[model samples]
Target: MKTIKSNFNAQGLVRIDSDDLKLEIKFESSQIYLNVISVNPRNLKTFFNLSDLRKLVIDVADKLAFWKFDLTVTWEGDELAYLGQHANPNILQKFIVAKNVEIKNLKGFAKLLGGRST
Candidate 1:
């Protein structure tokens, strides 16, 4: 287990920077909600909903099960939505099990987490 140093500011924002990944999450109210500000390698920043990311992963897993590929998303924006800094492998495993994907390489499937493409 690694320690995540989360930085909080006066404007209700939390930042996490590790190696080559930068994550800026913002909190608006007291309802325990946060919006991802930027999760990228460099020169590229983006924001996306967590729920949307899970859906995209599940969709990709489905397509992978059907077509057999690492990344086949055509839409460019869809690529951005799938990448997130805080996406744990446990989450992926849960989605894979829930989606009934009989794939073991589902872990570390997000090769785009640090903006790597193949």
Candidate 2:
């Protein structure tokens, strides 16, 4: 695995920056896998196939199964923020298994102790 020199500030936020963009990913626990993404609003179709994992896809699925859902995420904002709609307590535990990402509660820990996004 390749190692990236990254740091989490006192507030516990992981900031990632590259040539094209800058983004922040906050972990409630300590898992590297997340369920959110941002795509070109006008051409999401073009970016849709870029990856098989979509964090909102996972979070929404989780919300569908259970009325209330606890989650962990890492992705661009605004685009993925709408997922809050699924956070209702009435539908949180409906799905036991889902094909998409896994929902984890980070609770304030960090994952990927020394690795970069794959």
Candidate 3:
């Protein structure tokens, strides 16, 4: 996991890039916006299977916990375009909530919760 850039203070943005993923998060007055691109063996264009997608969301929710703020996630690249075709906003909220609960249950997790700027 490598941080490309980060500004995690109020109304900030963070970008992290790794071999398998590229994640960008922006904090605003009313919400937190997340943009994710999954790079995997199957597809270079950010294709995500169900398992991968779930894991991505869980990891994100765990690392960045801001329950008070509304969350918005944009799945980037061509493979995830299907989600937009069948969009249901509630699904994302439920998934995030569920993942947040899972994270809370595991003690001593997210040692580097809010990432440092580079």
Candidate 4:
């Protein structure tokens, strides 16, 4: 894994590139935005397999465990294919689970967290 760039000031950002994936983590106010993209050449014609997708999510979740910020994951390209045509909430739930971290409904924290998109 390689960190392409990082800034931890207010409204910070971090970009990591590894294998065929890119993780862009941005901190804005009370929330954290995690954008995961597949950089594999083959992804142009195919979606990420379940194993790779799961690993990506778990890896990101683990890395962000130290932050108390609410997280919003934006799916793109082949990643969206894995999420299905409608962005299945159930599958998304599985991906966002981190060891010892509580995943809560965005509705409950929307006001306090500044209404970040889920």
Best by the TM-score measure: 3
lDDT, residue 18, model 1: 64
How much lDDT does each candidate structure score? 0.38, 0.36, 0.46, 0.49
lDDT tens readout by residue for model 1, 52-92: 66565566555433432232221222322222222233566
Residue-level lDDT of model 3, residues 4-100, one tens digit each, is 5343445889998988668887878646666775434335324655567557765555445432334555553222211111223345545653434
The CA lDDT at 55 in model 3 is 70
TM-score of 4: 0.36
Scored by lDDT, the top model is 4
Could you tell me the lDDT of residue 107 within candidate 2?
23
Evaluate residue 75 in candidate 4 and report its C-alpha lDDT on the 0 to 100 scale. Answer: 45
TM-score-based ranking: 3, 4, 2, 1
Of the candidates numbered 2 and 3, which has the greater lDDT value?
A: 3
Off by over 4 Å in 1: 1-46, 70-97, 100-118
lDDT score of residue 107 within candidate 4: 50
lDDT of 2 by residue, 1-118 (tens): 9645433222245665554334555544322324333222334333444233344465565453343223344443212222232333223322532433343422211121111333
Candidate 2 C-alpha error for residue 54, in Å: 4.5
Candidate 2 vs 4: which has more lDDT:
4
TM-score, every prediction: 0.27, 0.28, 0.38, 0.36
Instruction: Estimate the overall C-alpha local distance difference test score of candidate 4.
Output: 0.49
